[model samples]
Target chain A: MIALDYSQFLTFEPQHHWRIGIAIYLFLGGLGASMGFIAALYKHIFKKDDPSMFAWSTLLGVLLVNFGGIFLILDMFVWESFLHGHITEIFKVLLAFFGAAVFNGNFHPWIQWGANFIALFSLFGTLWALSQADKAAILNKLGFLVKIANLLKPLQSVWGWGTIIFGLAVAAYTGFLLSVAPAIPAWSHPLLPVLFVISALSTATAWYMLWTYFAKGKDEETQKVREHVGHQVEWADIALIGLEILAIGAYFNYLYYAYAGGKYVFHQMLSDMGFVIGFLLVGLLIPWILEFIAAKKHIRILVPLAAILVLFGGFLLRYYILHYGIYTYPWPS
Target chain B: MQEQQNKQLPNWVFVIDLNTCVGCNACMAACAQENQTPYWNEKWRTKVEQAEVGKGDNIGRIFFPRLCMHCQNTPCYYACPTGATYKTPEGVVMVNQDLCIGCEACVTACPYDARYRYDYEDVEHNKQLFGEEFSIHQLPHIDKCTFCYHRITKGLEPACVSTCPTDCRMWGDLNDPNDPVAEIVRSGRAKPLAVHLGTDPKVFYVGLDTLPAPAKEEAE
Candidate 1:
C-alpha cells in the first residue's frame, strides 16, 4: 500500500506583520520612559537637597513617557482611530471586562491597560515634579500653579513611589505583551518577563548615565554633581548588567530543556549567527566587559561607549525577538 | 443554567477524508471566490498544501486542506486583549471586525498560522453577494475562515464542502450521534493535528497512517 505524504500538508510562512521598526521604537520608548520615572524617584528620595537634579530628572521622565506614548500610537494599525474617536469602543470593551479578566488570569488586557495607565501617571507625576522644582522659572511665574504645587508638597513622597511602581509595571508589561503570544514558542516562556525587566533596568541605568554625563551643563557645580551621580550609577549598572547576563542564560536554558519546539526555535534563532554575535557578543558581552573596566579605571569615555552599546543591545534584543519569532509548525500526526 | 446553555449550543466539526482528496485545489478556489478575498493577497482563509514524501520509486504526494481549527480552548481567543476574536455558542471562532484593533495579537497567538491581517483594498464587486453594509472585505482587520458562518446559519453547507469535486469534505453538527461525520470521528480513526498542544481542535483527519513522513529538507 502506498503511504500518504503527511508532512507537506501545509506550508508555514513566517509572518512579518509586526515590523522591526515598531519593535525598536516601542522598546526604546518604553525603556526610556521607565528609566526616566525611576531616575526622578531616585532623585526625590535620595537627593532631595539637590533641586536641580530632581528637575532635570523629572523633565527627562516627562519627555520620555510622552515619546514612548507617541511611538506606541504610531505602531497601531489604525493610529488615526485614536484621533477620530474610534478607539473609544475598544476602551469601552476593555473597561467592561477589566476586573473580571484580571481575576480570571486574562493578563493580556491587563498588561495593555496597565501600560497606558502608567504612561499617563508617570507623565503627570513628572510634570508636577517639574513645576515644583521650578528650574525653568516658567512655572513660578504662574501664581496659581505655584500655590497648587506648594499645597501638593506634603504628598510628594507618595507620588514619587507611585511613579516608581508604575514605571516598573511598564517595563514588565513589554515582556508580558510578547509572552502572551502562544504561537511564538521562543517568546512564550514564563521567564521572558523576568528577562525583559532586567534588560529594561540595565538599559534605563545606561540611559540615565549617558544623559547625566553628556546632556547636563559643564559648569563646575553641575560637573561635580554629574561626576558623583555617574560613579554611583556606574556601580548600579554593573550589578544590573550582571543580572541581565544571568537572566539571558536562564532564558536560553529554559528554552533548551522545556520542549522540542522551544529547543528547535532556540537553535533556529541562534543559527542566524548575526543576531547572536550582534546582540549577545558585541551588544551585551563587550559592553559588560567595558563597563567593568570603566568602573575600576574611572574611564569617562569608556562609560558613555558602554552606555551606547547597552542601548544598542537593548534595541537588538527586541528586534531579534519580534523578527525571528518563528511559529512552530504543527506536524501532522 | 450552565447545563442548559451547554445543551443549547451546537457542536460543529469538520471532517476531511484524506483517502478521497485528489489535491485538485477546487476547495481553495471556491473558498476564495466565496469569501471575496483580493487576488493579490497571498494569505488565504482556506488553502490546500501539498507535501511530497519518500524517495525514488516510493515517492508520493498528499494534499492537506488547512483552515482555522476552531479549538474548544482557543489560544487566539485568550490572547486577544479586547475580546475581538471570540468563539460563538455554535463552536465557530469569529473575529469582530469593529472591535479588532489590528494589533496582530490573535495572529501571533494562533499555532495554526490560520489568521492573517487583511491588508487589501475593499473592492465593490462583491456588494451584491455580501450586502454593502456587511461586505466580506474589511481593511486593517484580522481575518480567518469562519466556517462560512453566514451560509451555515442559513441551513446551507459551506462553499468549500459544496464545491468539493471529490466529496472529501464533511460538515455537520457533531452532537448528533447519527451524523456521518460524528460517526467517523467517534470511530477512533480520525486524528486531530497537534493533539499534544491540547487545543482540542474540531477538525479531524482520517487515513493519516497511510501518509508518508514529510521530506526533512522541504520542511523549512
Candidate 2:
C-alpha cells in the first residue's frame, strides 16, 4: 500500500489565478537571460576578432528581454484605473528598475530581484553588443553608434562580465518566482529554481547552436570560427539535456512524498498526454537520443533538429509549471 | 503592529454560529447587494457552502458561510508585489485600488481563495446597472470580502451580519470584553479554520461537530 502522512489530500483544487501571459513571460525571460549569459561566456573564451553569433546573441537577448517585458505589462496592467494603456505600462516596468515602488519588498523579493537582474543584464548586454566590430559600413557611419562605441570602448571587458553575472541571476530568478508562492504546493518545491536555471542554460546553448549553424553572410575565417563553436555548443547541449532529465526526475520524486498536493500534480502530469508525448518523448528523450547519435555519427541535420526540440521542451516546462499547480487546503482534520 | 500604530481602532472579529445557519443564503444575497460583487459570474465576496463534515456516526451536513478570513499573518499582503493589499488598523484587510497593478499574485497566494480581479468590462456593465459610481469600485483591482470595511469603519456592522434572519453571524470588536463575539471566540466555543497555516483568521465558527440537534420542545 502507498504510505502517506494522511491518505486524504488537504485540498484537491487546481489554482487558476495566473493565466497564459505569465507563462509566456517566464519562458521568454528565462530564454533571454540565458542567451545573454552564453553570449558573453563565448566572447571571452572563444576570442573572436569579428562580430560573430555571440554579438547577435546579445542583440537577441536585448530584444527578447524587451519583448518578454510586454507580456509582464499585459499581465499587470490595470485597464480600469485612471493611468492605463501600452506606453504607461512600459514606462512603469522601466521605472521599477530605477527604484520605483513597483516591487514592494515587504512581501515578495523574487519579482523585485528578477526585475533588477533583467534591467542590469539589458543595460550591459546592449553596451557590449554595440561595442562589437560591425562589418556593415552603414551602421558604423551612424554618429551615435560611432560615438557610443568609442566612448565605452575601454570598459568592454566589464560590460561583458556584467552581462554574464546578471544574465545568470535573471535566469535563476524565474525559478524562484513561482517557488516562493507556498499556496501552490506543486510550485513551492525548492528544486523548481534548480530545474528552471538548468533548463534556461540548456535552451540558451540550443539557441547558439542554431544561430552558428544557420548563419549565411559569414567570411571564410568567421565561418570556420562559427563551425568550431557550433560543434562545442552541440556537445554542451547534450550534457545539459542529460542534466535536465536528472533534475526533473529528482524533482518529480521529491514532490510526490514532500507536498500534500504534490502527489496529485505528479499523477495529473503523468495522466496528461502533453507531458508524456509533447514534453518527454518528442521534446526531451527523443531529442536527447538524436543529439547523441548526431554527435557520434557527425550527422549535421540531426543537431539542429535536436536543438529545436530542446527549445520546445524548455518552454513546455514553464507552461506546465505555471498551468498545472494544485493548491492543498489547510483544514482542521 | 497595526494596533500599535492606531490605538483607537478596535480589533475586529466575525463569529458565525454554524448550528444556527439554516442553509438560507440571506448572507450571500445581502453581501451581493452591499458589495456589488460579480454574482453574475458565480463569483461572490461571501458564499454559503454546503459541506459534509466528519465520518461514520459523526457525519452531518451543514451550510457554512465562507469569506476572507483576514489573517493576522496575511499571505496575500506578503505576496502582493506592489504593496496594494494591506491590513488596516482595525485588522480588516483591504486592497488599495490606486496601487494595485492587477498582477493577481495576491489572488494566487491567498490559500482561502478570497480574491478576484474586478476587470474593466465589468465596470461598464455595473455602470449600466447602477449608474456611473458604485461602492468604491471605480477602478479595477483585486476584490475580496473586506468585512464591509466601509460600513464597519462608519459604526455599522457588515451587510451579511446585519441581514442574517437567524442571528447566526456576529460582528464585534475582539478587544471589547462586553462584546459576546469576543467572548465566544475566547471561551473556545468558536474556532478558526486552518490554524496550521498560521494565518490567524479573525473569523471563527461554532458547533462544527454536528448539525445542532433539533431544538428540544420546552416542558410545561
Candidate 3:
C-alpha cells in the first residue's frame, strides 16, 4: 500500500474575495443578457413582422446588463477608496494599469474589457431601439436623437448580431475567469467554459420562459404570440439542459482520470452531499426531468416551476464551484 | 581570485542544507520582523515544515524550511491580470504594490502558497514598510518574500540567512561557476522541490537524500 503522509499536511482556508455576490452577478448577468440578446436575434431573423418581442427582450437585456454592472463595481476593492476621498486617484491608477494590461493581452484584463464592451453595447443598443419606438417621451422630444435613431435603422441586423456574439462571450468569460486559477484544479479545465456556456443558455431559456408566461395577454392574438415564444423557449431549454448534463458528466470523468490533484478535487466534490444532492440532483436533474415532462404533457404550471428550479440550479452550480474549490495540499516530496 | 569575482555575481539563488536544518523557526521570526508582517496573520514568507518517516523504532523526523522558490516561469507572474507581480532583472520575483488590485489571483496561482493578501489590518505595517502614499494606493495588494530585494540590492544578506542559528541557509549567485551554491548544485547532490512541476525553482536542497522518499502508488 502507498504510505499516505498524514503528517505535515497543511491546508489553509482561502480568503473570501470572490464570493457568492460575485458568483450570482456573473451567472444572472451573463444569462439574462445572453438570453435577451438571443431573443432579439430570433425576432430579427424569423419574426421581423412583430418587432414588439424584440423591444421587450432588449429592455430586459439592458436592465440585466446594468444590474450586473452594479454588482461588479461593488465587488472591486478600489470602490472602498471612495470613503477615503481617493476614489478619483484610485480609479485613474486602476484604469491606467488595467488599460495597459489589456493592451498587452493578459487574460483577466481582456475578459474585463470584453465584458464591459458587451454590457455597454447591449445597454446603448436597447436604449436606441426603445427611443426609436417613441416609448420614452424624453427621447422622442430630442430632434438630434431622433435623427441618430433613424440613421441606425438600417443597421438593426448588424446590431442584433453584434449583441448575440458579445452575449455569448460574456457567458463563456465567467468560466475562463475561474479556469485561469491554477490553484483550483477542479475549475482549471477546458470543459468548464463549455459547461458554463451551456448552463448560461439553460438559465437564459428558463428566464425567458418565465417572462413570457407572466407577460401573457388575455387577447387571442397576444396569447398566440406568448404561446409560440413559450413553445420555442421550452424546446431550447430542454436541449440546453441535456447538453449541460453531458458536459457535467464529462467534466467529472475528466477529473476522475486526471492526476492526483484532480482526483482529490473530484473526490472532494463527490463527498459534498449538499452540492451533489442539492445542486446536482435536486436542482439540475429534477428540473431537467420536469421540463421534459412539462414539454410532453403541455403543463403550463410545471414550466414555471422547472424554470425556477433551473435558475436555482444555475446559481447553486456557481456557488458550489467557487466555494468548494479546495487547493491541493503541497505534499512532502 | 575567482572567489572574489563569484561574490559579486548576480542571479541570486538559495542553498538550503536540509541535513543541517534543526527546525528552529528562527528564519520565520526574522522574516516576519524584517517584513513587518502582522502577528495575527499566519501568512509567512519562510517557515519550517516537519514530517516523520519510517515505522516505530526506525521513525525519524525531517524538517523542511519553506520559502518562495522564485521560479523561472512563475505562475503568479503569468496569472497577475495587471502585471502587478513581476520578475526583477536580478531574477527576484517581486510584487509591484502600486499596480496590484488585490484581486488575489497571484495568491491563488502560487503552487507553494507563498503569496498572501495584505488586508486592512496590515495597512499600518505596510505603510511603515513601503511609505504612506504607496501603502494607500496598494491597500489590499498581494505580498510575499522578495528575496529581501531592498537588502540584496544594497549589498546586505537576507535576514533569514543571517539569523539562522544552524547556518543551513546560503544566499549567493547561481551564475558564478565558483559560487558555493553553484558548486553544490554542479556536484549532483542538490535538488529543487517539485522539480517535475517545471517551475525551475532557484532554491535547492543540498541534503535531500537524508529525507524520506516520496510515497509510491498502492497496489490494487
Best by lDDT: 2
What TM-score is obtained for chain B in each of the predicted models? 0.87, 0.88, 0.83
Specify the highest-DockQ model's number.
1
Tens-digit lDDT string for candidate 3 (A130-191): 53443333555667766766777677666666666667777777777677555567667779
CAPRI class of candidate 3: acceptable
Give the better candidate number (1 or 2) by TM-score.
2
Please give the range of 10 consecutive residues that has the lowest summed lDDT in model 2 chain B: B211-220
Q: Write the per-residue lDDT of candidate 3 for residues B113-186, one digit (tens) a residue.
A: 77777755577566776688654324556778888888989988899999999889988777787887678877
Q: What is the lDDT of candidate 1?
A: 0.70
Ranking by DockQ: 1, 3, 2
Distance from true position, residue B96, model 1, in Å?
1.9
Tell me the TM-score of model 3: 0.84
lDDT of 2 at B192: 82
Candidate 2 Cα misplacement greater than 4 A, ranges:
A1-11, A45-50, A78-109, A133-144, A216-224, A330-333, B1-8, B52-60, B187-189, B207-220
How does residue A221 of candidate 1 score in lDDT? 71
Pull out the clashing pairs in model 2: A11-A329
